[model samples]
Target: MPVVSNPLRALAGALISVLAVSGCQTLDDAGRVIGRADLVNDLAARLDRSTELTYSADYQLPGGRNASISQSQDPLRAAYTYPGGKLTVTADATTACDTSTRKPTCTVTAPQAANAEPSVAIFADMRKRGLVAPPVVVGLLTAAALDPDATIRQYDTTVAGRHATCVEVDQLSDAETAAFDACITGEGALGSFTGTVDGTELEVALSRYRDAVQSGAFDLPAGAGLIDRRADGQPPA
Candidate 1:
């Protein structure tokens, strides 16, 4: 959760504290009430709503690296493939595979496991490695929606053969967000994004997107070692 140094966050913290006590709005340098309680709220809304859509998206990342996301609803299962690992979450279990070793392996954890530690650590690690998934991007937009001095402009673009609504967020007063531009397709899929989030510069684009996912999209990688802690109650190894 490392973030860029923004002297203003301290000021924001102070102002927010006062606002908490005084029930007043936080104002920016121009004395304007901060926060985009306006139309920009829809941008964040779109990203959040994307999680409910059943689709598979491939993202082209910087340095020729790539990632993909496949998700389905009703049961709410998702699989994300990053540079060296894959993380899948299902109603029944959380499965993660680390391919950094000579032989990749998957560790499975029950839904009721303590704190869901394995997936939590893996997710935090991925976030630090510049994974700008929809949820993470949503957090950035939410913060901007509250920053009065932040400037947001809207435009249109096409990604992966689909039209998308894009927004550029800049001149933010927050410490963590540097520059953010995201495109959300009509189907609620993230079309593309470029910029920094929490000190991580993430450049990603949707190469292809499909509203339907293939069978076994959530299955663990084939021919890998397995650690089943779903019932053993043992720590992840």
Candidate 2:
């Protein structure tokens, strides 16, 4: 894993002296701060790094519901699977799978086509549908870093055999109550998170992790109907 630069850490340390240490909330002049700079900065940096890596991770949502994230680069793609459905995105196609029925069907769309089936607003759609995806947690942590009024208490724990730093943030005002808690692994993957987003309460913990993505990480449902809305109307192989 790449450690954040030294100059960034030095600046964060100075801010910590003036600010309180209850929870580490780092504010960059902009967003380029170092890892371990503060609780919030470190976590935010970890999540930001995770976006570029290739891996597959399993998560256990609140009430034992299952979810997962499979991500890879090259063409740049990812799949977020939760309970009964999944959403997969790539440079050319966006696919959403509905598995509640006897036969699962996937609807594919050209990412730039008009009236895309899954909608180009991918992250917003997942949060509205109450999916506990990792990227959403990343957003929360990133926001917390910029909140001056947010106070955090730090803790340490291990999730899926990886050590993670955890924090609980308490916001003084209603405007700042963004996230409740978040944990980040050394490799920058989200270890766990719990909070209300867009009015829905979501809680999830990492259950398993693989450093490398497996074959067929972006594969759609096996033996399912396909609705391809691309210009060519060709199905995925």
Candidate 3:
């Protein structure tokens, strides 16, 4: 499949790849050990315990276009709202892709629409069409921490009036000499992430976090014009 060039997904995939190559003992800036495998373990535990989460961030793209993104996550469901479009992927692997503006409403059904895990379905749909989408900053961080080669070191920092641990990924590429920074809260939830791509700097900060999701957030709006991808034999956009 041809690689899709969605800037956000590309950035996420790159960050994840870098973290995958790095080690696990977290440390302070002074080189003193804070905890062994703290970053990895905390992220894992949080994801396992939380039934729902919400993330909101503003993104500055390479061309200087600004975007605001909001995401809601549930056990086997997720919804992304950005600009004029909204996408909801249900636990059954059904994706309702809708745009409030010019685009048409569409539904794409995955092969495992009935039996697969929600996370599995969501991830697969995100990666379909060669797109490397990470549903939220927390999701990306959790995935990176789970990588066998991931080595995350922590430094002290503050974000949004909250004390945080800054986890860094250095040496992403020899030519670029760039580092990725993800600041996480004491409970391992994502606070913010900052990195540069193609000379454009991007930063995402979590403005809100929740432990429960509203059932209606995952439903397609009433009276929406629906285009079934399966019936039309069309590709997902």
Task: Give the candidate number with the greatest lDDT.
Answer: 1
Candidate 1 structure, TM-score to reference: 0.74
lDDT tens digits, residues 92-201, model 2? 66788887687988988765433222222455555555565554554455455555555667799999999998878677244534557878788877788887776777
TM-scores for candidates 1 onward, in order = 0.74, 0.70, 0.51
Error of 2 at 87 (Å): 1.3
Clashing pairs in 2: 23-152
* Consecutive 10-residue window with the lowest summed lDDT within model 3: 125-134
Runs in model 3 deviating more than 4 A are 1-38, 52-76, 96-100, 111-153, 161-163, 173-178, 186-188, 196-201, 210-216, 221-223, 230-237
lDDT (Cα atoms) of all candidates against the true structure: 0.66, 0.64, 0.46
Task: After the best TM-score superposition of candidate 1, give how far the Cα of residue 22 lies from its true spot, in angstroms.
Answer: 16
TM accuracy, model 2: 0.70
Candidate 3 lDDT by residue in tens digits, 43-130: 4444333323455433333333333334454234445544334565443335555555454575766433222232433434322211
**Residue 185 in candidate 1 has what lDDT?**
85
Model 2, residue 176: what's the lDDT?
30
> How well does model 1 score by local distance difference test?
0.66
Order by lDDT, highest first = 1, 2, 3
Which candidate would rank higher by TM-score, 1 or 2? 1
